[model samples]
Target chain A: MRAQSEAHAPSRMVSETDELCQKIRRRKPSIYSELLRENILEVLKCSFPRFGTALAPGKLDEIASHFLSRHGAKRPQFHHIATEIVEFAHRGHELSKPLICLLEYEWILLSTEIDSARIQAPQLSGNTNWDTSKISLNPTAEIVATPFDITLVDIPVELDGTEQNYVYAVYRTVKHTVVTRSLSYVDYCLIDLIRREGEVAFNALVSAPPVQLTTDAIRQWVIEQSQNGLVICGTEC
Target chain B: MKENALGIGLRSELLEALCIQPAREDIDFLEIAPENWMGIGGRKRDQLDILADKYPLIAHGLSLSIADTVPLNVGFIRDVCSFLNDYGISIYSDHLSMCRDSSGYLYDLLPVPRRKENIEYLTGRICQVQDIVGRQLVLENISYYHRYEDQMPEAEFLAAIAEQSGCGLLLDINNVYVNSRNHLEDAVAMVRCLPSNAIVYYHVAGHLELEDGSLLDTHGTKVGEEVVRLGHEVWGWHGPRPLLLERDNQVPSLDELIREVGDVQKSIAAGDRYACSI
Candidate 1:
């Protein structure tokens, strides 16, 4: 029994202390819980202004509390927490679609702007067969398909899901500026296909159902995106 | 960095003003959280590069969790080392409290039990962190809400950790003041017991006095006169360590922060003269 107690000591301490932490957080009038809740709400407000106004008083606190209790052990960096809040909010379907879309757009911009991953430079592979070359989106880049063009709206109040057909490719440039560009439907379809599949051969991209554009047009677009650092070709084949 | 050097935390909100005027006469050094800057690029990275190039940067980390029960995060320590090396920062400090548990990071500086076993547990962990960091890990005393039963004095607990692990202390005056007010302890007595040589620097900030009369260490306001006075007393005891003003939220313009820096500098000068007289 002594040996068993000794063996369980470390685990026992962790459980006891962690449980205490949970209790302290849940206890009424807990300043610790208030601090955590306030911090999460502040970050979200800065990132998602419209959504901040959309939520009622203490609503964000409840949501943030739920998020913290569920994922308490996960390290809470500002960007990571923001990402989790976006996902959590989406899963709950509490906010309107437009608000969610705006949150997603802002999150992408914020995350990409600060992303430190060094993506490989888009280089033209010297392969002979161009149709078989691999294509990929820049790791720092993101693509969004919104029903309406919410990007132009300064304040998003209307929740009406208008289908204005907006597809955007938000990416940071080599100069370190984050810029968004509108993509043609064909280009969006092609990029979406590439996103769904990790990296695709040029031949596969051309044969994909979205490639209603001429083969030459698709080839031109791929080369243009590669040169712009949006995608990389595995080989020039 | 000279003794009694006045510094300010390099918050992102004040980045633009700082960049335009990087060489403020009153400012001595800049403190940054390595966790925030690590693996980040673009405008923020560029801004960091510009500021780091101009100032002597010190790393005051928020996520090291040196007092936790889990195994040390060697990868994060290595990453911090890499960043420090990249930018030529020497002093790396974190709170001497647990911010994480086995389940995950709690994202708050939770109080560690002030018992002998915890001291022993934390001493070993601090040593491991120091070994990995390749320098002495300076720990700050955090202000916490809850108190444990059969616990040693907070100052004694911290001193024990430092003595056992051979680590340094970042004596945050505002935290001392806040904890003393909240816990009904003698703030000056606690500061007096800390080993003088172990204190590497000082952190002074403003805190909020809640309706309950308990103080919260919120770095969102101007540095209070009482905290500044305590800082002066600390300088008198330790003979003027670097005093860093931390303004993490509601950060004002650079001019305003620099003015605060100048205020601390004036107090330090006064303390210096007072020391010379004695």
Candidate 2:
């Protein structure tokens, strides 16, 4: 039982030893702390460049240190750490809504670029039969609504926290290039519906609440989005 | 890849440069941290496919955390093996230190206690990893800063693990030099202590010296002259192995790195000639 416990929960076996080493590490300041701290900071800086710039002096470092002290051991991958940094900022930092939104925007861009999930759109030899086809958004596509125009902010000061009422779609194209597009509320609602339902029929989409569009408008919009590689036309209705 | 071959750690920064010159003669092979490539897609995946076709790739994992007392991360090891199999790479190396504890991954290699008693524990883990990888798991000696109580020399610990577990060793010459200087040990003697049969490859990289004289394994700059001299001694002792140039940060242009690779090759040849004459 002891051996089994040691094998399964190795930390339990050496909790005292680990504690001792942690104390020694703190006193001696090994390369581990510096290297780990640097990795976290580098990821945060790269993921949200504007956020790094906006934070006051040493705030970014504090955040990185906090993250390292808290979640450093938890995340081994760079993207995973980046995600935790964004999450920590939102939950703990009391960051401005604009700043949080900006971080989310930047994260979406970084996340979709490397997202492994692929969506295979059904091959349409003829034109996509809009009336009978099921429509779905690309798996890599993400939609976010922000209170402020975080995209328009050029500098830290430009983000005045005023409401800009922005809705955006960030998705990776077939070529794997991440593209961000500002979306109208109606388009946002349609994408949200497709995202929530997984697959939506053409009539169902047109008849959906918050999407009171004519058949022609809906068809045109779907075609436009398809051209943009944001929407995929699935099986025959 | 041939013995005495030169390779470079393939960083994403070098992808554009590497893609342009797939047939470059200076780089005999490419080493990658499989952790970076696994479960990733997009243009990066496409780039990896192109490069894999061009040069033979070896897997050097980052998050194995082999020395952790907890159960082995079998899932991650399998994924790494899968990546290696996909690329037709059989040589896989990771640090002989813990990266993850019970809480989670530290994202940095922490020192494994070098006491004699650890040999059995470490041996078991190493053997388990080798079994999972379906190949000899080559363990690199990490540059640790501090010493622990009742610690044996790192060389002894490493040699024991390699011999007992039948694992291979990646002799990071820079790390050896750093640890030697920091801990007041003879670097060459440490290399001599390691079992020759277990030493499979060599890692030559740059390091930074702190104000207090302790060396940091930064891998930021060019391989230092002292480390190159040590490499000469290492190759002379172990004969020429597949030596990889690791530059994790402040990476220069490909041309500059290629030139550096050429320099190391020349040094290794000179060392071999010296050994033959002796």
- Which window of ten consecutive residues has the lowest lDDT sum in model 2 chain B? B269-278
Report how closely model 2 matches the true complex, as a DockQ value. Answer: 0.40
Candidate 2 residues A1-237, lDDT tens each?
Answer: 011212333333366447634543343375667766777788888888987887779988888777655543454554576777777777666676666777888888888999888756434446666677889888898887777656775534445556467788888888777888889888888998999999999889889998688988987788788878888887673
lDDT score of residue B141 within candidate 1: 93
Could you give candidate 1's per-residue lDDT for residues A205-229 as a string of tens digits?
Answer: 8788865777788788888888777
lDDT of each: 0.77, 0.79
* I-RMSD for candidate 2: 4.7
Q: How does model 1 score by TM-score?
A: 0.82
Those runs of model 2 whose alpha carbons end farther than 4 Å from true positions after fitting are A1-17, A20-30, A90-96, A119-128, A154-165, A201-204, A207-209, A234-237, B272-278
Best by TM-score: 2
In model 2, the Cα lDDT at residue A38 comes to 77
> What are the DockQ scores of the candidates, in order?
0.32, 0.40
lDDT of 2: 0.79
